[model samples]
Target chain A: MTSSAAATIALTDVAARRGNTTIWDQGSFDIPQPSITAVIGPNGSGKSTLLHLLLGLLEPYSGTVEVFGSEPREASEQLGFVPQSYHVPGSDYLTVLEYVRLGKIGNQFFWRSPKGMDQQVADAIEAVGLAGYERRRLRHLSGGEQQRAAIAQSLMNQPKTLLMDEPFASLDVRHQQRLAELIHGLRMDHSIGSLVVVHDLNPILPYLDGVIYLLDGHAHYAPTSEAVDEDLLTHLYGCPVQVTRTAQGDIFTRVTGHAP
Target chain B: MIELPTVTVQENWLEILTADFMRQAFIGGIITAVAAGAIGYFVILRQQAFASHALAHIGFPGATAAILLGIPITLGMVTFTVVGAIAMALTGNRLNDRDIATGTILAFATGLGLLFSNIASTAAANVQNVLFGNLLATTTSQLISFAVFLFLICLTIAICYRPLLFTSISPEVARARGLHTGRLNLIFLVTLALTITMAVQVVGVLLVFALIVTPPATALLLTARSLPALFLSIGIGTFAVIGGLVLSALFNLPPTFFIVSITTLLWVIATITRPQNA
Candidate 1:
């Protein structure tokens, strides 16, 4: 089922609680399509929760969630996800080529290697610059390469909206740069929108088109080029944190004044 | 099965085949071989080799209780082990996290088995076959039951193949795709329970672990893919079963021990020398 319709993720009056503590309450947000949106928040400030709700992973206590204007499962053909966890243990024997092939399974474009799977696999690997490593086992790949393979797997079907959680969690500068480039290319070349849930927002600033500032069960929006000053940073982080733009051409996080 | 392996190795070999006891042994080995290999694939994938062994051992007490009750032991063993497997799957991601829970379940089941066994006055050697396995007693009826187990396993795996594989490998990914993960896990557990129950008579408890783990472990060295490894593991298991059964028959050795030994030896050698990628 090819859906040409606009793909938007919206949550309304969503609240979640574990035991008695309310993690999020009456939070509402609408993410735009054809754009790269960054979801940034402190550890317990409902970052992953927001992503989960959007992806329909966790049903909200009281709200409606729609992806591509349909239920998450209903529109799964238009969505793809790269989760935060590492590759599953005991499944380390899968080759990079076969591992990535899983991304294509649910869709109509799935390839069991007969018709046109090779090109798709090659393109995905080259897009991530993991060209020579398809034959390597998933366990043997470096953390960054494995991340790329994960991305390759997620993109095997060329999803309309790709959801990634901490995609650059533990990568070196080179890998982070490569991933940033690929994310940029996905937006430009494939026109595939992306929502990235991240703790450290500075590394992803370059490729982002918008920001979903979440704080204590609430979310606000800002364009990527806007000045995310100390006030905005502190409010989003739920702590006093200074945002500095350095001449080395990068942003830095620093401790600011004590809260009043 | 194969003309009784008319061999010159042992004077007892030809004579034993004539005994109803030898016929049961051969049929029993064949039954457990197919049953173990089929359920073992998921056991290997769920990384539940240890957990499955623990599940099989759980039957000891139930079997003992049945022995004391004078009821058929197979039904008693299946009922308890299936419950054990289901309980483990239902609890929090028992497949992941710490081994403390598996350790607890193992101790509890073994304790129950001991309790029942201690109460039994007859304490027939047949209980040992149920606990460890006794291919020497595999009768025609048991062989039919095993064939049914094999058919059930094939049907279950066939119907739910993709979802099962998806959950087994990348559960988070499968969940993101909105697959029914919890139900699929239950299906896998049910399949595993069938293996333990069917093989309990032929290979016993200790060797059941070896049956479920060894072929897959060795196949892991040769294939980095899931389907291929599954077929390859079953293939390796069939060979192991045949070799062990024949060797035991020819030389008058315990079939379970012989099969497990050969399988373990090969797995260890493969682990040492096979390409490290897998």
Candidate 2:
């Protein structure tokens, strides 16, 4: 692993509020280059807001955020985002290939179709395991396939950093594994930095290099091993949380009073 | 059975079309139809049909006020729709729920139109033209304006095609990729306002909504590709305009009535026979 000084994204004493409610205060974190970091938080804990701040969609009321040594807005092309619900509404005519092609639209020339864009789009689709489904309409795809297509679309920009919000929320276990594999492959092959917001950390814990926990409008950056500890999680969630290790040496979380 | 309107016996379709006004109306209507058809595709794609409708009604008072002030109705309609578009865009940006802003703008516009039409009794003579259209009374200058505006719209679409499509599909993703979605939306609303002005001169305020929605809706039902649907919409709109002009001339009825009827009929047919990916 590279040193902390080689961080691709750095936030210094950032604070953000939306409509009279403070989402985050004095939040600070560093996302290293070419690493997968899970942003774990309960609902309304500003996990998505962190992504928004990094994407320049929302500004921090105080402090600074830098991506690739520049402002978030200036480094947008180097950053790709896969939103929680990438199924764009009211577009029945949009095909998978066309949807993926939209990613390249931001950086390419607008007046004419760029040379080699078709090959690039095809490569992206293939990278996400959606090769045969290029011409299919987006609405026809399964939830998992749609998510893959969204990932392929994000990959069209060839971003160095990818930010995803609740990507595994709607997928089944099988699809979640498939998406994790794809994300792991991206991190390994391209050294693409990733920050994924997850409600349940067990699904992606195997591929995550580090974790950032948000609680009570504060950020807690921890190593992967320390992040999954029972005492740390119990303190983070304000509940008695259990971390169980299975026979295969895999870890999972269970709330003390909740049924499996 | 419905009572049939008495038809004026004309020498021939060719003979009726030879009049300078008929020729002008035909050409001008075609121009408006082409522009509306192209613009309508994005309107439906982005789900801005209701906003477009509100913009048309908002232009009503502008046309009436122009008549009372002895100015061109086109200028008045353009000015009012632009103002309404800006107001609605700003409100939509702030509220996040565009329906509330659009509804509020529509109601306020309708109220202003009612007040203006009632204030100047002399302008009431032209109110019917504003509400129902005056295609037969279209002047050469209006046709020129239509052509110029159509060129500008086509140019704008051509230049901003990719970015516009990206923003329309998923604004958040596009914004993350550095496309200014708010500015794009504002530009789209203003362009919609211009389109409303053009179609208003041909189909009037009430029926212009049909021209701006029905053809694209029908095309969307028929095709599965955006470009193909766009071309299909243009074809349908142009055909309806020409057919409506001919039938209105044959029946000696108001052209706006026939145009709206024909466009609605096209939509019904397209819906019933829509392809199920066959």
Candidate 3:
């Protein structure tokens, strides 16, 4: 099947399995370039599996998954990923400068820090608003700062697209808003589009241009306004879900019922 | 109650330094310390302390078998440890599975060492030396082997520093970035095996942690920067070896005993004085 030429990510009838269990199958979606898209789904709806597929960490059972007009693995250099957990092993001893410098590493024989690597690391840190945190240990940073440092590490490659897995999982609302602004700023200044996997979509609803919601073993994508319908969300969640707008024109979603 | 050995410093310092055996012990101990210090950082970073301990025991049979065959003990130790490392690495990245594999292999290797030692009854002392180390018995040929192994380890680490650090911390991200994480894991385990083989010569199989884990573990308590921590680990390892040698000469005790004691004391001190939130 031919994918849209302009789409940054295109999945055609993609299916994924974990062990003997089929997580999701018959999934198809397209995420355009220069857009902030949220990948939202209920727990175990294969939200992370979708990110893994795009990052070329998993194989589709019987479908084509493309990123930037090529197989996901072939376009890995053009993509950056922020994993769900920031608790990396041995990160306790890594300074911000050292950890951020890791992003410059690729599949290379010898590791010679490129000329101006320090400046580039500094720039990435500054871009994340972590300007004076170069010498701070990752374990010493607050949750929001750690998330920003992870973002800075991802940006070291100057990736055209970023894939973040649950970037707001443990953050307070204020930090979440700040992260939303950072994502928006990345898109505006660096033209780096983001496909963020999130459980609660309200925190990022203001900046999100589109969403890819996984449900009933399929993925569907739509613009934010088109996807925010109460019935659609209620059906997707298999519970009573209410999508409401605040007085300041902000979108909020609340699950009005307990687990079925 | 066991009686302690008489504390005596009869040998002149200059004369002790000039002795061939003393020189060999110092050289061998220093080389082993350097390799252990460098690799122990990663060992701790990767949380593979158990595997590291297992690798040393896995080499025990090899050393005993080499004694039975009248071959170089280091060669046999390297062969067994590297093979064991490959087997453990093949078990994939799950710590639980890897530990099970390492423990299983360790059990079998210990059984084999017992068999080899039984067959080479006349060389029981040699087997004892392998278990607890006899650094003074390190031959010139074995010293050469230690130097060569140290060079290879340093070279490989230098060439693969960034990726090694990257994979050690966040393997999923490294794999996503197109790094061959499996191959890197294989390389790291092999290097770790080599370091274990060398460390076994100084502290022997049972006390390998003295050089391989304790120093780095202590260094980690004091600092949160990679380079500084690594250097501090090396310094601690070096000090333990030299101090152990000197104390052994003064007290007429086993160098391994002093080495382990010094490292354990340092680790205790570091733990007590460890910085908060570091």
Indicate which candidate wins on TM-score. Answer: 3
- Model 3 chain B is weakest, by summed lDDT over 10 consecutive residues, at B9-18
Local distance difference test values of all predictions, in order: 0.74, 0.83, 0.87
Those runs of model 1 whose alpha carbons end farther than 4 Å from true positions after fitting are: A1-5, A18-20, A106-119, A238-240, A244-260, B1-9, B15-24, B94-99
Fraction of the real A/B interface contacts present in each candidate? 0.41, 0.53, 0.63
Off by over 4 Å in 3: A1-7, A17-22, B1-5, B272-277
State the RMSD for candidate 3.
Answer: 2.7
Regions of candidate 2 where Cα sits further than 4 Å from its true position: A1-7, A17-22, A61-63, A106-109, A258-260, B1-4, B7-9, B94-96, B122-125
- Compute DockQ for each candidate against the true complex: 0.44, 0.55, 0.59
Q: Residue-wise lDDT of candidate 2 within A1-260, one digit each (tens)?
A: 34446457888899878888988788777767788899987789899999999899899889999987779888887888999978876544678888898788743435677789999999999989999988788778888888888888898878988999999898889888888888899989877878999988878888878888887778778879889988878877777799998899787887886422
lDDT of 1 by residue, A1-260 (tens): 34434456776776765566677776666666778888887787777776677667777777777787887667666677888884777447777877777666632222244468778888888877788888788889888888888888888877888888888888887778777788888889888888898777766777778887666666666777653667778876667888777899777676666765
Q: Best candidate per DockQ, number?
A: 3
* Pairs that collide, model 3: none
Can you write out model 2's per-residue Cα lDDT over B25-136, one digit (the tens) per residue?
9888998888899889988878788888889988988988888788888989999999988877776764347887777767877788878888878777589888888889
Q: For all the candidates, what are their Cα RMSDs to the real structure? A: 4.8, 2.8, 2.7
Please give each candidate's TM-score: 0.90, 0.92, 0.93
The TM-score of predicted model 2 comes to 0.92
